[model samples]
Target: MKRVVFAVPGSLDTPTGGYAYDRRIMAELRQLGWDVECLDIGDGFPLPDEATRSAARSLLLEVPDGLPIVVDGLALGVLPDVAAEVASRHPLLGLVHHPLALEWGLSAERTDALHRSEQAALALVREVVVTSPTTAKLVASDYGVSADHITVARPGSDPAPRSRGSRSEVPHLLSVGTVVPRKGFDVLVAALATLAALPWQLTIAGDLTRDPNEAAKLDASISQHKLAGRVATPGAVSSERLAVLYDSADLFVLASRYEGYGMAYAEALSHGLPVIGTTAGAIPDTVPQEAGLLVAPGDVAELAEALRRVIADAELRRRLSEGALASARTLPTWQQSGAIFAAALEKLA
Candidate 1:
């Protein structure tokens, strides 16, 4: 049987979109009879301390030399030395959801370090797989990795029921992602604050535990805007609960500063909800113009304007909803993406 080791940082069961992609892709590989070893290399990735790095290095070293190893970019980017050592014996591959250096709120030094290490790691890998086309371009150009070395396997979107919407005159706005600075939750909340005169209830649902200070600041912003009643931060929700949120919501919004491939936006499109997001990274690629309105990242005023128009105009919402469904139909299934991912690995052997 074909064999490979898939090393991911943290719990494979994490609720974030990146983890979800990892989970589905692995399942697809297994179904194809690949001997997939999903290894948890521990946490604090991309910025792991010495102890964490040592533990991760030891675990990776234990993998058989003949089997290919696909390391998630989260930890791999920062572990260039370990990757080089491992690549000397194994056919090493890198799965880059997005370049780690592109993440927001990093110090200049940290960004530079990540860039250097990732460049070094990518150079050693047999192949690099990215989650989005935009990422493919960036990695190739900025990181000096060849386009031929990179494969773009976009995230799959499952079929979802069209959003019935909040029957109430007041619209329900939904934004989902881990509450981190990179997500631009602060920008989203600021935009909503400006639209307080409008009748809207917002639910920013996703894991808040990744960055407690960011979550607390988000809470503080809601309170300062006198929007505690209208806005709900229910943290991470189960799949069932997120589905319900998508179904019952009138609109979806997330002013992310950057996305390797905005899976949340793709999920919103699949749900047939109008989107309000920034034109950052691969967001414009994920949420097409007909399906959503895009604003510049971190521009609260622009996002607020987009929000004001979509929430107030039902006809616009209907048009966008139709577009979202149209866009959703074109999205690949998990099985298809998985096949592509599996095929890439099959060729690696």
Candidate 2:
């Protein structure tokens, strides 16, 4: 049997898009007869302390030589020295969801350090696998990885039943993502506040623990705009509850500052929900204009205007819904994504 080790920083069951992609692809790979072992390297990655670094070093030392090992970018990008040491002994494959340097709210020095470290670490890997073509380009241009050595295995969306939409007089807007600066929940809240005159309710479902301060800021913004009754944040919901939210929502929206692939946008499309998102990162590539409206990141006026148009015009919503359903049909399945990911690793082996 072909055996490989998948190293990650935290629990495999984290509710974020990257973790979800990793779990789904790994499970699918196992079904395809590959012996995949998951190794948790502990949390606080990409900014790991000495103890965490030592733990990672020890864990890697125990892996058998010449094994094909795939490391998540979160841990791999920060461990250039470790990657260099292991390159000669193992076929190291770097799985990059996005560059760590692209993360928001970082100091210039920190960003430069991360960029340099990731560039050095990625150079030692046998190959780099990214989740989107946008990310592939970023790796090639910013990280200096050769185009020929990189592969794109985009996230796959599950087939979903068409949303029934809100049966109420007021439309329902759903946004799914962690309440972080990168996810731009603050921008979404600000834009929604401008549309208070319109008849709509907003629900943001995501992990509040990822950034407690940001969550608090979002709550303050909602209250500042006098939207306490109209806006509800139930924190992160289970898959079953998220499915219900998608099925009953009138539209899906997220003003993320950036995204590697924007899996939630794809998920919205799968449910035939019209999208309103920013043109940052891979969002424009993932959410086509026909199925959604795109605004510049942090452009509150444009976002509010787009939301108003979709909410007031029933015909527009219907047309966009059709477009979403059509677009969702073109997305790859998890099985296909797994096969592509498997092929990339196999090439290195």
Candidate 3:
């Protein structure tokens, strides 16, 4: 039987896209008849303390030799010593949601530190799994990993009912992601504040606990713009609740400075909702121009213009929604994504 140990940091059921990808991939592997064991190595990853790092290393070392081990980049990038020590014993693979260093809003020194650490760890892995083509190219060029050594197993979208849209007089906007600087919820708020005269309501649904500072900043921005009534910032939501939010929304928006794959954007498209997002990172790759309006990342003016154009024009929204449905038909299914991941693991043995 095919067997492997999947090491991940934090809760397996975390609502973030990275965790969602891991959870789905693990499930898919089981469906494919692989003996998959999940190894939770603890959290505070990508910036874990020394104690957490040591504990993670010991947990990774516990995996039996010759059983392939796939470590999520969140933990692996910070555990260089663990990678080097176990590379020869267990066939090691890395699942990178995105390069850690490229995360927006990091100081130069922090970015440099993360880059060195991830580069060192990636060098020892047998193979790498990236979520998007843009990330694959960046990983190869920046981390010195060969293109042939990487697999791009994009997050799959389950077929969803086309959104019936808001029943309200005002257009409903939905944005989903953890409240963090990289997500640019602050930028979205800034853009929306300018268009308070427009008839629209926005709900920013994501984990507010992940980055308390950013969450606080977003709150301040909403108040500063005096848009407390038109905007909602509910924390992490249940699957059923998010589905309802998707069903009731007319437009989906996020001003993320960067995305490894933009799983939320894909989810929006799967729901047949028109998109308004930035062209940064893998967004353009995920959000086709025909289905959405793209703007420069962090540019408040451009984002505002895009938001105004989409919210104000019913014809544009309908056209983009149609395009979004067409694009949804082309995204891979979870079963297919799992097969690609399984094939990559099969190659290890």
Instruction: Score every model by TM-score.
Output: 0.99, 0.98, 0.99
Query: Can you list the residue pairs that collide in candidate 2?
Result: none
lDDT (Cα, tens digit) per residue for candidate 3, span 232-298: 9889999999999999999999999999999999999999999999998899888898899999999
Clashes of 1: 0
For model 2, how does the per-residue alpha-carbon lDDT over 1-349 read when each residue is reduced to its tens digit? 8888999898998889999989998998998999999999889897899999989988986899988999999999999999888787999999999899889888999999999999999999988999999999999998889998899999988889999998888999999998889988888888888887889999999999988998899999999999999989999999999999998899999999899999999999999999999999999888898999999998899989999999999889999999999999999999999999999988896
- Tell me, by lDDT, which candidate is best: 3
Which is better, 1 or 3, measured by lDDT?
A: 3
lDDT of 3: 0.93
**Clashing residue pair totals per candidate (backbone < 3 A):** 0, 0, 0
Question: TM-score-based ranking, best first?
Answer: 3, 1, 2
Q: Which model, 1 or 2, shows the larger lDDT? A: 2
Local error of candidate 2 at residue 97 (angstroms): 0.5
| Model 2 spans with C-alpha error above 4 angstroms | none
